[model samples]
Target: MIRLSNSVVLQDEELDITAIRAQGAGGQHVNKTSTAIHLRFNIQQSSLPEHYKARLLAATHHLITEDGVIIIKSQSYRSQQMNKDAAISRLVTLIRELTREEKNRKSTKPTRKSVERRLDNKNKHSIVKTLRSKVRRFFE
Candidate 1:
């Protein structure tokens, strides 16, 4: 079982892990060993709560596929076990992020003092600009 959080635990069977050979240049060892791991988690078919499932699917547009499967590929490590652990940890992290509730923003109008200060600044700026212009008098 993978424990995502205190409330969320994923059954081992829910996760599908595949071992594949790591790509790129790493000598004969990389070519011979299947150190990479591919993890696929079906969001729609999980035991997760309905709201959590909806939130996960909505938040992770890049990670979740159209079919509601989350595909995680981990090949950063040299050993297959390490790669498998990495993939599982990544999946847990993604769900953890979605579990956090977004703090609602409080709608507030500008304070009277601030609004007055802004107007005062605008008045000062206009004064400065007016001074920059040639002073015109009735003597013209």
Candidate 2:
């Protein structure tokens, strides 16, 4: 089991890793060897909690495909083993991030003093702008 958090855990079989050719400057080694790792995890079919699955789907709509697969491409390292490890690490990190519960924001209203201060600041600003206007003689 892949432990995401204290309550969240994923099965090993859920992750699918495919070896692919890595791009970029690597001389002839990049073309000769398939070192890059393509990691896929099906979010919709996984054993994750409903709330977590919903949030994951909502938060990572770009990453998740129409088929509900989460694809992660890792080619940072040259070695296949390193790339595989990196992909798995990324998957764990992503899952961990999803599992962590966000702090509930408490609903708050502006204090009476704060509201009064804001009004006072607005009045002061208005007065400053009023002073910037051209003076006019009313008793002509």
User: Which residues of candidate 2, in runs, are more than 4 Å off?
Assistant: 98-101, 138-140
What C-alpha root-mean-square deviation, in Å, does candidate 2 show against the real structure? 2.5
Among residues 3 or more apart in sequence or in different chains, the pairs in candidate 2 whose N, CA or C atoms overlap within 3 Å are none
RMSD of every candidate to native, in Å, equals: 1.9, 2.5
lDDT of 1 by residue, 1-140 (tens): 98877877899999989999888779757667899999999999999988889888787568789888999999998989999989999999888887678899999999999999999999999999999999688775
26-93: candidate 2 lDDT, tens digit per residue: 87566789999999999998999998888777775555687778899999988999999898888888
Query: Over all chains combined, what TM-score does candidate 2 have?
Result: 0.79
Q: Please report how far candidate 1 places residue 6 from its true position, in Å.
A: 2.1
Q: TM-score winner among the candidates?
A: 1
- Every candidate's lDDT: 0.89, 0.86
